[model samples]
Target: MKKIYNNLTFRVLTAILLGILLGHFAPSTAAQMKPLGDVFINMIKMVIAPIIFLTIVLGISNMGDLKKVGRVGGKALLYFEIITTIALVIGLVVANLIRPGDGVVTTGLATSGSAEAVSRYAQQSAEMDWMDFFMHVVPSNAVGAFAEGDILQVLVFSVLFGMGLTRMGSSGQSLIRAFDRLSKVFFNILNIVMKLAPIGAFGGMAYTIGTYGLAALLPLGKLMITVYVTMFLFIFVVLNLVLRYYKISLWQLLKYIKEELLIVLGTSSSESVLPLIMDKLEHLGCSRSVVGLVIPAGYSFNLDGTTIYLSMAVVFLAQVFQVDLTLAQELTILGILMVTSKGAAGVTGSGFIVLASTLTAVKVIPLEGLALLLGVDRFMSEARAITNTIGNTVATVWLARNENELDMKRLRQVFNKEEIDPLANYDY
Candidate 1:
């Protein structure tokens, strides 16, 4: 049983089969099981702020040469900004052309009941302002930010502390070293916690499918399917282009991190894989500083999947309402998304929040469109998290290669090596 559970293929297949079977026949029990998924999500969320803080500050301060941190970070941020803009545009273009949400005449699309409950919750997401978004990044109390699980705030402080460490000469070096060691300890803890991913995956999937079954997807299946398909294409084709341009093998990278990817697929939160991916990227020859800085930053800005969803959903709403937009209006939407989407990493239900915020930013779409996506948004969150992980992972590698910071021999060894146990020396 342990062997079967450890086998990725076996675990995935078993989970899917069992989840479907339970979802089909015993839905009430499955609905009651949602707490398990909640627990897994909370566990993943629990680590994010601290993990980001420890990793970023330690990764930065440990560097013997801090100058390159700025150089690498600048380049990576630039790359992220460029690609995210393109992603927003692509989503808008495809959505406008396809018009998946147009003229649906969705009856029973009321702002009440289950959808209303979700919409009300989503409305809370809609209320956060852009100024508030910026203000939220500067922690009012550092400890409070961690308690609240605000990753961006933690990241902002980490960068400042790391730079201060760099400037403080030897005295700060000792503290930085301590943080570095602490970061390693946290990673080890995370590694141990992640061993339970299959269980979490099984529980989460069983609960979701068992409760919702295929019926819940009926009303919004087209939108969900469209988003999923577009996300898949973006990961394989668009991300592959970026990877191949850097001479990285997509297959090799995927193969090397199969366990981490599986955990992401199962848990549906990229945050769950942060530690594992950091370790994997380092093993793949990206400089630790590059991985440390770029990844956290990427989380906030380089959300390729979420960007795709925002673009798709916005136009989708417009089409649904049969509203026409001028070229200027579309560009304004793109610009607003560019601002609102960045630095939004680590917000719970942030994709929806960002989508709502983006819609608000453009000032053309009614907040009502957010109501349309309420029922199905939970299903799409996993895709957003997974694609964001892949995009950031690829971005880290590409940035490393661009800076000539990658250890080619180590990368080849890490990605190409095979062993009796896939987890061997692959510890996060």
Candidate 2:
């Protein structure tokens, strides 16, 4: 009983319930709790850049073969694109079938002043230059990349730095040891920061419900149900089949990462568990090199959840505006989303901008329809974040097994809950 009470999952679940109650009864006060979530996310972000740099550098240097690094990276990217595109198709198929926006009354959906609400996203979308986005991957100022917590930019630098260190061979062993120690220090910091996760969960849930209220979802309930069910099926059906093909058990893998899932559930940010999950994957039997390369790369490229949401939102908006898209137009929208979706790069608010860009490109869906999503978007982010987190985790494990990098015996031990967990033993 005492152990259960101390459990992170239990505490976070309890916090979520308390937050819902407070938001319902005293919204004014609940809104003030935003800082709790914000600060906690900031705390997690505080360590992300350094963790990525150190983990990648150490993993690369230790692996001792730069060609293998490139191979693993290529495989990871290939996997990301394939899985995410499938997710996009799943979203479109489900949305077209259910047609959540078919009967939505646009006027009552707070659409009157929607232009003002979504204008900033439109502006951001217009300002986004995809060439610039790809170019920005090579950080002009490495310090600025770290300071801004730019994962992609930091990633580019870390890979090169690690390669450089690896080429030094025996000459760089001292530095590698120092980096390995520093990485452990940061992981310890991660452990300390995570203890406050329940508080963060409480603040996040309270702020969302207080600001939007359960009533806000009523108007968009059909869309919400459709989105959730689609994601659920994608996870259980699609991801499960992938796991089964690889001879890995989806249930054990999800059970392994349940704490991180709940953290993402409460916080609505897959990034909140980014570094933690990387470390957890290594302990789960992935080589450090594979975990390092796959997880962060998956973070940006393998956004199964975001792709699903983007496709479904486009279809939903077209239905709302009574725009009858022919088969060609729908295919064109799918093509447009394929490009625009990558523009988000896992940024928090950028998902909306990418959606705006997709809508703008499609030239059929009302750009103002983006505003209809604001009230219900937070509620759906849990689904997106959870799926994104799980997808990345699965991708890493799958890639590791395929590359013959996973320690199958050790994986069995960890899944069996027998011994050796680098991330604390949560017995959940």
Candidate 3:
């Protein structure tokens, strides 16, 4: 009994249930818990920049092979594109088949969402420039990137800085040692912050249930069901096949990351677990260089869940308004999402904005229908976040195997036994 109570996984799970009950019974109080989640997420975000900068720079300096860096990066980007496109197509196919919004009465669509909020997202979407996303990759202000916690910008700078370090040869040894110690220090900070996971989980869940309420799901229950069922199948069937081909067990990997999954489930923000996931993947046998390069890059370019949600949301809106989209239009959605979803992560409310951008480009679906998704969007975010985290983890492992950077012997040893604590090494 004492052991179970001391377990983070069990504690988080308990917090989630308590949150749900409190939200159901005392909504006003539950709503005030928002700060708990917000503060915890911010605490996690606080360490992200330094960790990414340090890890990538450390990995690259140790690697000391500029060609290998390029090859690894090229491979990760290619894999992200292929897998995310598949995710978009799968979402479209399922939404078409399920038709989640087939019979919804359109009369109440606008009434469900705040017009001000709808206008805000639409305006943001209109201002989104694909070129700007590309330009920001080479951040003009290095301090600003870290200040804003822009992972993509930091990654770009880290790669360049690391390349510079690699070229310095033996003279760089002292600096490399200093960076290594700094890395361990930040990791230890992460270990302490993680102890608050249950509080964060409780607060996040409570706020969602209190703000949105369980009743919000009923109006769009079919759509919610379709999204959840689709993501579940995608994880169990589609991703499982990827693992089976690579000779790894999906269930085992999921179990190993169970604590991280529960945290993400509660927070509805995968960023909550970004640094922790990168660390766990390295401990699970993926090469540090691959984990550092692929995971952070994957957060931006490889958001499988966002793509799936964007595709399905468009289809749902089309069905709601009874606007029949032709094959070419659907393909247009697939194309636009493949690019725009890359910009979806790392920003607040970016998913809806990205959806608006896709719909605006398609020039078919009614933009106002986006307001309809507002009610249940928060509820569905968990599915999106969980799938994205799992997808990135799998991508890192796959890339490691391809690059011969994975230690298969250690991987098997960890899985062959009970769940190994991913943070045992960082626990100071």
Per-prediction TM-score to the true structure, in the order listed:
0.89, 0.97, 0.96
Q: In terms of lDDT, which candidate is stronger, 1 or 3?
A: 3
lDDT: which candidate is best? 3
Full-model lDDT for every candidate: 0.75, 0.89, 0.89
- lDDT tens string, model 2, 1-428? 99999999999999989999999999999999999999999999999999999999998998898999999999999998899989989998999999999888877666446677699899888888789778777899999999999998888999999999999999999999999899999999999999999999999999989888999999999999999999999999999998888799999999999999988988888999999999899888888888888888888888899899999999999999999889899888888777777867856587798888888888877888888898799999999999999999989889888888888877888899886645643221
Worst 10 residues of 1 by lDDT: 419-428
Tens-digit per-residue lDDT, 309-412, candidate 3: 88999999999989899998899888888878876556679898998888888888888888788888999999999999999999998889888888876788
Candidate 3 ranges with C-alpha deviation above 4 Å: 109-113, 418-428
Model 3 poorest ten-residue lDDT run: 419-428
Q: List the candidate 1 regions with Cα displacement exceeding 4 Å.
A: 1-4, 109-126, 171-177, 361-366, 418-428
Clashes found in each candidate (C-alpha, N, C closer than 3 A): 1, 0, 0
Worst 10 residues of 2 by lDDT: 419-428
Model 3: pairs clashing at backbone N, Cα or C within 3 Å: none
lDDT at 286, model 1: 75
lDDT-best of 1 and 2: 2
Q: By how many angstroms RMSD does model 1 differ from the true structure?
A: 3.5
